[model samples]
Target chain A: QQPVQSPQAVILREGEDAVINCSSSKALYSVHWYRQKHGEAPVFLMILLKGGEQKGHEKISASFNEKKQQSSLYLTASQLSYSGTYFCGTELIFGNEKLTFGTGTRLTIIP
Target chain B: DAGVTQSPTHLIKTRGQQVTLRCSPKSGHDTVSWYQQALGQGPQFIFQYYEEEERQRGNFPDRFSGHQFPNYSSELNVNALLLGDSALYLCASSRQQISGNTIYFGEGSWLTVV
Candidate 1:
């Protein structure tokens, strides 16, 4: 099943911070985060395993909670280049090699 | 270092027609996955190919098929295309089919079915 994302869309000032959340109904082995700009492919940001270790990529970071089957992405001091749609992909089992993606969260940054 | 590459960046097809999109995986990757992204939506996985065989598939119908060659190049074939099939087709590649491996994506092929 597709995961659910919160705050369908958000606009932030260039130096502000934003949080995007993803929740799954089923248990997940891992959560992957990606950002996609208009007219471009989704770019891999980071992946969080079920162990609850938070992963960070530049100003972006994410955390996964196995018990809640949820993950949250954090973008700090958002930059103009951070404007894009964020997606969370969940893997139900280890080595499944298939990801169920969320609807997506659109983030826009303004100067 | 080429990441992932896709062909026919954009195209148009008539309903009931067929279309084929191509992709080349990153230099050292051996797995290829296909996805469909409609407007304002996240990418939906179509399938994944490894060792020249389809190892995993998504919720798509049989009308969506794919083939992977020895060199890790792949092609997505859509039969009896419909207007609903109009979307951006993305190709992704990862190393060794690892679940947590970083997957690289191509710019995608935009198909507009009229």
Candidate 2:
């Protein structure tokens, strides 16, 4: 099943911060975060495995809640380059090695 | 190493026509996955190929088929295309154990069905 993302879209100032959430009805084995610029491919940000662990890269970080079957991506001090569409991909324990993605969240950073 | 590469960056086809898109996996990668992303939506898994075999598939229709070559290159073929099939087709590649790890995606081929 595909995951559900919150705040379909968000607008933030250059220095503002935001958090995007991804939740699924099925138990997830791992969660992946990717950002896609306009007319560009989706770029991998980071991944969060089961066990409710958190991983971060630069100003982008993500946390996975195994019990809740949800994950969240936190963008700290967002920059102009962070403007793009963010997608959360989920891999379920019973899924057949196929990663399903959420609807997507559009993040627009302005000066 | 070169990342995932896709051919025919853009194309236009008529309804009932057939189309084929090609993809070459990254160096040293043995797995290839195909995805279709509609406007304003996330990428939807089409199918996955590993070891020159179809390992996994999504909920796509029977009209959608794919093949992987011995060189790790892949091709996605859609027969009797419909207008709704117009979207960006992306190819992703990873290692053998594609359980949960980084999967690189290509720039994608924009297919337009009239």
Candidate 3:
């Protein structure tokens, strides 16, 4: 099943912060976050395993809550470079190589 | 190391025709998956292949098929395409693991079905 993302779109000024949430009904073993600029492929940001797992890349960080079947991506001190579509992919327990992605949240960071 | 690479950056096909898209996985990657992204939507998983055999698939119809070569490269073939088949086909590769590792995606092949 496709995950659900909140705040379909958002705009923020530089140095601001934003959070994107992804929730799935199925139990997730891992959650992957990625950002895609216009006309470009999605770039891997960070992967959050089950509970108690967190990963950060630069100003991007994410956490996975196994009990909630949800993940949240935190963008701290957002930069103009952060403007893009953010997607969260979830890995299910069935061991399928497929990663069901969320509808995506369009983020715009103004300079 | 080179990341995932896809071929035929853009393709145009008429309804009822067949089309094939290719992908080369990143170095040391042993698994390949295919996805379809409609305009303004996130990618939807099509299927995945490992060890030259299909291991898993999404809810996509059987018309969407794929193959993985010994080198870990893969191909997505769509038969009897419909106008709705027009979309960006993305190929992603990852390491086969029980934990489900992060998959790297290619730029994607834009297919237009007239």
DockQ top scorer: 3
Query: Candidate 1's residue-wise lDDT over A5-87, tens digit each?
Result: 99899999999999999999998988889999999999989888888989888888999988899999999999999999999
Higher-lDDT candidate of 1 and 2: 1
Assign candidate 2 its CAPRI class: medium
Let me know the TM-score candidate 1 reaches against the reference structure: 0.96
| The candidate that achieves the highest lDDT relative to the unseen native structure | 1
Candidate 3 ranges beyond 4 A from true positions: B97-100
Q: Residue A39 lDDT in model 3?
A: 77
State which docking tier applies to candidate 1.
medium
Q: Tell me candidate 1's interface RMSD.
A: 1.7
lDDT, candidate 2, at A105: 96
Single out the weakest 10-residue window by summed lDDT for candidate 2 chain A.
A90-99
Displacement of residue B3 (Cα, Å) in model 1 is 0.5
- Candidates 1 and 3: which is better by lDDT? 1
- Compose the digit string of candidate 2's lDDT tens values, residues B76-95: 99999999999999999877
Provide chain B TM-scores across all predictions.
0.96, 0.96, 0.95
What's the TM for model 3? 0.96
Model 2: colliding residue pairs = none
RMSD of 2: 1.6
By TM-score, the best candidate is: 1
Candidate 3 lDDT over residue span A23-90, tens digit each = 99988888989999987888989877776487788888988888999999999999999999999998
